[model samples]
Target: MRNIPTRHTAGRTIGGAVAALSLITLTACGGDSGSESTGAAEKLGENEGEVSILAWPGYVEDGSTDPEVDWVSGFEKETGCQVTSKVYGTSDEAFNLAKSGEYDVVAASGDLTLRMIAAGQAAEVNTDLIPNYEGIYDFLKDREWNTVDEKNYGIPHGYGANLLMYNTKDVTPAPTSWKAVFEDAPKHKGQVTAYDSPIYIADAAVYLMAHQPDLGIENPYSLDEKQLAAAVDLLKAQRTSVGEYWSDYTKTQASFETGDTVVGTTWQVIANLIDPKKAPVEAILPSEGATGWNDTWMISSKSKSPNCAYAWLNHISDPEVNAQATEYFGEAPNSDKACEFASEGHCETFHAGDEEYAKKIWFWNTPINDCLDGRTDVECTDYQDWTKAWAEIKG
Candidate 1:
């Protein structure tokens, strides 16, 4: 979700954890070790005096937005390393920026983390260097997007789901499935909305997996040409009723307020921001489930201040620190300990630690020709295919 201003970029260089275990798919393509190496540090050393970071706007706040929203100051004070940071609006933007090797670390969404690893822009993180690592959620550890070839590349930060949000007054009978926005979308006619990104195609694939089981779509991110075409067809139909596609959180909330959009997909953060007294809207995870995000904090392979970078990683993963970060960013924290640090009801509201709820979410991962689900019988379409298909659906 675009919770902050468009092009909201900033920087902090600091010195940074070990934390816990989780079971999940490993989605990154670990190119051979022979792939270009930016010099992954063999061991941690003295604070390098400074560290640089690239992240989503709200992910790296130093109290600039609100004085109380500062996580960076404490890290700098404890490590004696100054912090500098740059924030990006989208995963694609973050991926490109990381490639420049200008930052020591990055908070990458699942969609970009694996791609960065495959491109060798990020390196395998030495988990032993992070003492706070033991605090992370077991389900998030060694996941496909954050680990490659059984090697951990980064730490699982926080996560949230894309929910089906609707104006309670207008969307009758309370929608329970994705069909409300797909097959039955016309009933809302010109009032439906959706996320404006190529990754959204996975949402359509998700719907097909349930409504048309014959498609044999096990993983929404792993789609062959035939399956992809089917998903694109469904989205193309949805395009007709889409009043507007959105990435900006404020714009989406505004649309709901004005009743320009009655039903569509949304982030939990957006749902929280909308004044229910005025908009009377509610968000739900439809029966077909939803596409979500599991962001990771990865160190750059070419980091000039590797020690400081590791320092920052460890600092952020601390239970108190992780709580502050996830709360500000509007997602469930990675550590069970973070739950104690959160405000009353915050953890329950986001379904924190609910393994069953997590199982329902198809976290975002970049599509690749080699099926991510381990199906060797067919070559699935890659991210480039999704991009092209998105354009056609939009047109």
Candidate 2:
């Protein structure tokens, strides 16, 4: 949901190491090397008897959240790898916490994955080692966001789009574009809300890309200073109408139900949690496209329990486990077979196999000086710049 800042923002480090990596039945294409532990473990050595995980809420459940929702217990019984978990609210917090070397694995959203790679916090994943890897959706594998130069980093967990949601009664005419929250923001005045993170800047950039073609913004995350300034300006104006900015998932839903927020950005999960009886609402992906996230379970490069980490990866990727996690988290699962394990029509609800539908959503990616949109001529503002700009906008 957020990323990159000043304090620990060190320059990228280069390393060399090819590990014996395989995905499902694929042959090992790389060899193990020291100094750089390829994100994969060479063999399923003995389970370390325990593993620690850093994940988003609802990803790793031992039924503590809901006794009926415990999947971690089954994994532990089968593999003898006890699990200890810490949940993070934002991608930025996950990225920072992963650096502390306390967790063996992390469920990283797309926005923070590459930054983790650049910082050497993530290892190259060898998919062959994962027994359930073959069942993953073909569309999620070997993609630029989770792979580097043809090597996989980790297994994709799930994905969903950030949709426009509004009070069905208060907001007339059923809004269909992000303009309701940007250009027409004043209309909602003090009743509008937005995701509270620097990443929300990309929402403005998405709006500008459609309305201001002269800005030449190809990718929301690849904005240069001029383009970023334009986005920031738009946000500064919209800030005037915003009732609150949300990062805490529960707070977002509570604000909507209480009528403090009438319109703004939201995830399908939050929309589901809101009681329609209390506040009738509707959500949709606007014509201008929307920002979204694709999360992956990446093992920590410094993990002392590689075997247990790999075991956890495989266990979570299993169709049943995948189904439990994705459904609870309110997103599409990464494994194609997970649908069979989901509730009736759950897969259809998220458009799990509709590649065409996915094309309309721009998944989050960390902003860097080297433009991801492929423009070398103009130097783009990095995440640190976004952090500084965000502070100014919030002020």
Candidate 3:
């Protein structure tokens, strides 16, 4: 989510095929922080030759005139590697593109990372190659989505929560529950919008998990027929109140600008940076508790240039790189040193260096039920099953 796309807010950049919009909310303002000292970045080693990257649109600076906000040139300059980038709207698209064996690395979200690893499209990361990797937090290092056993697959990236952001000017008291976009949305009638991605079906799943705890909806990704039915039912009700499904940042920003929807579930990064010239909106972390996500760099297992890829990962997650990403993306940095280079107030505003808040954030861990915590009876749903439930909800 953070800067990786959608800042994990409502799975904004998960790809239109999977969710709704292609969110690139990871700019300095896209999150809570903006600029930092890459002086240390100069110390990180260089990348050799050209590294092809399949990236989400806003992951790196796009040669925009805004030098104040650029990651590519700096990266290339620091690494000494030439760069060629192709932008895709969804993880599915990136996966398909990456599957072609064209790129060296991918900035994958939790939902898609495991699939990439399983397919052997991404190689397991050798921590020895990435000296800075030791800085990654322990919990993230071995998770259902990234690693198997003690092996690592990719580097820690950015993370953020899916908050219930809305046009407070229109929503009156504002919303405190997922029901605002589920069962209760109808009262608002044509003023509701849910995430526009297939994986977003998980948002509905998360709601059911909290509100219908009895369902034992432990893992949104792994739903049984009964749990799937409930999630779909809730979504169908939400769809009725929905005016439109959004998967593009420009579209959501525009929708809010036109006052098409008063309130809806959204990402913090996108919600915070909505083009104010277009609309006045506010983001709220609702009380029923909310679901969130994270984005990370998953290396291609078959990458011809694992060296360059590792180099890229090391450079990106370096404290300075991580800090820059956090400031621009408005999410928490996964790097310990990166926070030191972050803007003065960024630690508070974006949770940049706050371990306490970081602990509280339910960064979207790819849902698995073996139980991921340890259980004999439940196994998580595979992508195909989640895919099916997603389609049913859309229907």
TM-score of 2: 0.90
On the 0 to 100 scale, the lDDT of residue 307 in model 1 is 88
lDDT of 1 by residue, 1-395 (tens): 41111101110000000001111111233233224454445677799899999988788889988999999998999999899999887787787788777899999887787677767788788888899998788878877677665678899899989999999899998999999999889999999999988899999998998889999987788799999999999999999999999877779989998889999999888888888877898899888778899889999887888888999999989989889888877899988899999988888988888877887787787777767655668878877788889999999
Tens digit per residue, CA lDDT, model 3, 211-317: 89898865455466677678778888787788988766557666787888777877666776777766678786655555566677876655656557777787777
Lowest-sum lDDT 10-residue window in model 2? 11-20
> Which has the greatest TM-score?
2
Q: 24-139, model 2: which lDDT tens digit per residue?
A: 11111111122546555566789999999999988999988899999999999999999999998888788778878789999988777766666667787888899899888886
Reference-based TM-score of each model: 0.89, 0.90, 0.82
Higher-scoring candidate on TM-score, 1 or 3: 1
| RMSD of every prediction | 7.7, 7.4, 9.6
Q: What lDDT, from 0 to 1, does candidate 1 have?
A: 0.80
RMSD of 1: 7.7
> Where is model 1 more than 4 Å wrong at Cα?
1-40
Summing lDDT over every window of 10 consecutive residues in candidate 3, give the lowest-scoring window: 20-29
